[model samples]
Target: MKQSLTLSWLLAVAFFAHSQSFNNLPVNTQKPPLHGRHWMAITGKPLAATAGAMIFTKGGNAVDASCAMLAATCTMWDVLSWGGETQALIYNPKTKKVIAINALGVAPTGATPEFFKGKGMKYPPEYGPLAAVTPGTPGGLMVMLAEFGTMSLKEVLAPAMQMAEGYPIEAQTANSIERGKEQIKQWKYSTKVFLPHLGEKREAPNAGEIFVQKDLLETLKKLVEAEQEALKKGKNRKEAIYAAYDRFYKGDIAKEFARGCQEQGGLITEQDLANWKVKIEEPLMTTYKGIEVYKLQQWTQGPAMLQTLNILENFDLKSMGYNSTRYIHTLYQAMNLAFADRDFYYGDPAFPPDEPIKGLLSKEYAKERAKLINPDRNDPNAKPGDPYPFEGKTNPYLTLLEKWGTAHLHKPTSQNPLDENFLEEFAAGTTSVEAADKEGWVVSITPSGGWVPACIAGNTGIGMSQRMQSFVLDEKENPFNVVAPGKRPRVTLTPSMALKDGKPFLSFAKQAGDEQDQLLIQFFLNMVEFNMTVQEACEAPSFKTYQMYSSFGKHEKAVGSLTLNSEMPAWIRKELSRMGYKITYQDRTSGPINAIYFDWENGSFWGGSSNHGEDYGIGW
Candidate 1:
């Protein structure tokens, strides 16, 4: 009897341990049958993507759904908000053409370099009331929906407004909100929305916890009503969309925004808002491996994507092996080279002509510069090289190159070292949405607003952006990023797409500051050349180099390292170091990158989200 009892007790203990181990096992919630058609969507937050997909299922076109998703994301993901500027890349299968929308907001008219000097400030304020520019989200979304969409603003905005009025905060949303609480507390309006009743610290609102944004809901309703009224006047979708813009820019919303700016001594003016218009410009395009790549112009960091591709083309990437140390070194070299040029020349083309970074992305210029990359040696602190100019006298590209090369080579500079082991924090709280309709029209837009101050009061619920912090006040007493009368601030919000064989091949983008272009280039290479599936391409580890000073500073210059997810192979790191590429093993700091690729032969649409983000992609 004693032996029997002892055996039974041992068995019971063993069973309990087994059960506990099983409970602790990670769950694979990924559903199977993972392929589909009929419009696909991907973004940073899973809930935001689902919301956009739902709109598509309701017979709304990509633009309509994207517009709704953008508004909803601003409320849900405070880290990336609508109050900031936006840049988009769209493809029209009907026209077989790609177009870019520069919805970036301009500096206020009175904004000048002297403004910062007068304030005794050297850096452009990135957040608070000072950093705010004429917001372009309303205008950009309206333009897309008007020109390419089939649904009305009322229909598209209904779901988002409902979401704003009362949607549960997810774990991702809670994390971001908490992270940004300090900045949010500065603005009364932002504080009200994020921290309704603050006391001792407590658990943040979790996933599925209801969050109601009464003010934003009301704002959406007002726009919807105005749009409906315009439609009643026999205005078509385009006109009605403009009507919405007018309601925001010239109507009551504009008045409120202007009033807020004035009260806070901000640069935004009513004229700035009314005069704001989205520019429909030709996309900057280049061919890589017979695949056509399209990116926005200099307004954002779009040109870097082109330059990286140009450098990669010079090497036989496939032969080098994917994600190998050789491949990563090459990629790092290409990025550093392009980034050097981007820091010197790229800016709002609308800015003064003398800005040093223009024409860096010209095809002739790219080809010439691509030859300078040396595959074997890692020029740790490599200086920019002069590529023979194709345009005019002085060959600004070569001139700037020569000047920078001499300064870089001879200057007593500290080789800024990066913490090879320091991990970058993943920006998991933003959102992205992409859609295409049967009409052969595709729209991709990403809305973000974290790290900036939030106005919880007034229920503005929108988060602030730190983009303005990148601008430098010139020695000539000019505010390089001043909120001037009609000038938009420099931004990193670049959206991209690709075309192959005259069809929509890829629509993808991310929301990180400099990593946007780096990630996009990788996606393009992964899809067009490596033949990786959409999911595989997006899930792959990525790297970025910020060796030069851009509108964003060179603070991370010494940190010439790649931030890779832990999943990346250790051998790859060893190889990269051997090739002179500094390796920074990060858990995941790259922002959420979402992509959709259309397989012309398969007649199927492939969509996938980054493994590092809280986003999802689904189709039906």
Candidate 2:
């Protein structure tokens, strides 16, 4: 019900924002992309930003600050649930090492292709307990703190607990609740928690109305209690932190998760919960103009960004002119190629039929793939390239995307066909947080899973993830994304870190799904090629292609669909249209981005946020 109304509401809100920013941005003193001296933190909410800043002032490092911010934001944004998925990339300057955390949960012990194939489910249901996997956000956050944070779990989570206990949610969050009001009704516990006092249904809260989630507060407190009890029993802080992690994945919470899944006809079992563990691996690195860009391994769309950058290096972007017809066309072609490779090759490492990261990231493969681009007109299709010998082995395509029959692969009137407005609403919203300390310890994390479709694990008041839906039911020829027990679906929740001359240069993250890497590429170019500031790069107009199959529901591919930000010049818009590119302009499709960069020349730290989602950044 609220999603239906959000389009009109968001438009009103966006119009006011654009109007104000447009009038004052060029000379807007007290502008966005705020800077800090010794440190900086940027998050989706100002309150969450404060939580991180408070941790930093308390002598905590970037890892500590990130935990605090993420926990607080989960409290503030209904779109960010404690039981959601999380992926983070952390860089430690002293060790000169970067660790990638894959906190995304796996398919349940019983989630095989049998049920989905027999049921003829082209896509799984969006809102329900049956759609969920074991929740992982709580576990992931604890692991991060235990390994890299200076603060204890209890100390870091104080802010979030306080908010859940009692606080007034303003207009923005209230709108999100309104958006998912109907979905909340679809689940038993979700409705009980969100609409407890509202009689038959949930009503949107007005600004300044006192809001409370006592159950959620209790859930958070239980984790703290478990940790404190372990400490009392002679366990050190780190052991106690691990105790909390074990409690979430192997103890009482895990039991409840299994019980809820069983009752919901879901595939998860207690064993799956106990067996689930997040992986902390070294980053997958690729070079771009002498800088080392790092991303998560095969399970994410991270390499697609690397692939896009490699292809674009073959073209002189500055000479083509930024946002020009040729520039946009070239970008579209490169992105489509990368995405084709992504759909054909990318998959979970623990699962077979996944892409070979080493082969895909090789410069030689990029050089080979660069030859596929056409200069004059848009080609509304994606023909995947060979990424074999690079990965040590090869698997032929399950079904050629080109043979799918239409130049426009999207079926607008098909079941569950999503218009742009509905598509945005269905985005399974993701949030990003970034923190950097004077020691050069930097972390970028994208955490998400909300209550809209997922259940609150049986009275635990923690939302669960519908991440299992990210997999495909391809049983025969495709291996990249086929469903099976214990497989991690190909996720779009990728964070990035980079080095310039072997020194930490940039740490950033964004909230878009498959479109994330595309936006990240454009943001980097805005800075390197155009010499724009961190703030300028974030605020610059951006574009993305939907020509590649999306990572979410039904794997829909809107071929040749080019979505540009409304802020672009009119001439460029017309020029793009003239080239037969299926173009549409609205607010950003890649969503809001946030970053913290080191200004080497000035010997200062600079920070910026897209601020499109009411984000905030602080540096000091």
lDDT of 1 by residue, 510-545 (tens): 766556777778777765655656765675456665
lDDT of each: 0.63, 0.75
Model 1 quality (TM-score): 0.85
Prediction RMSDs, each to the true structure: 8.6, 5.6
Candidate 2 lands at a TM-score of: 0.91
Kindly report which residue pairs in candidate 2 clash with one another: 36-619, 36-620
lDDT of 2 at 465: 81
Best by TM-score: 2
Which residue ranges in model 2 land beyond 4 Å of their true spot? 1-30, 200-202, 391-395, 398-408, 412-418, 425-427, 451-453, 475-478, 587-590
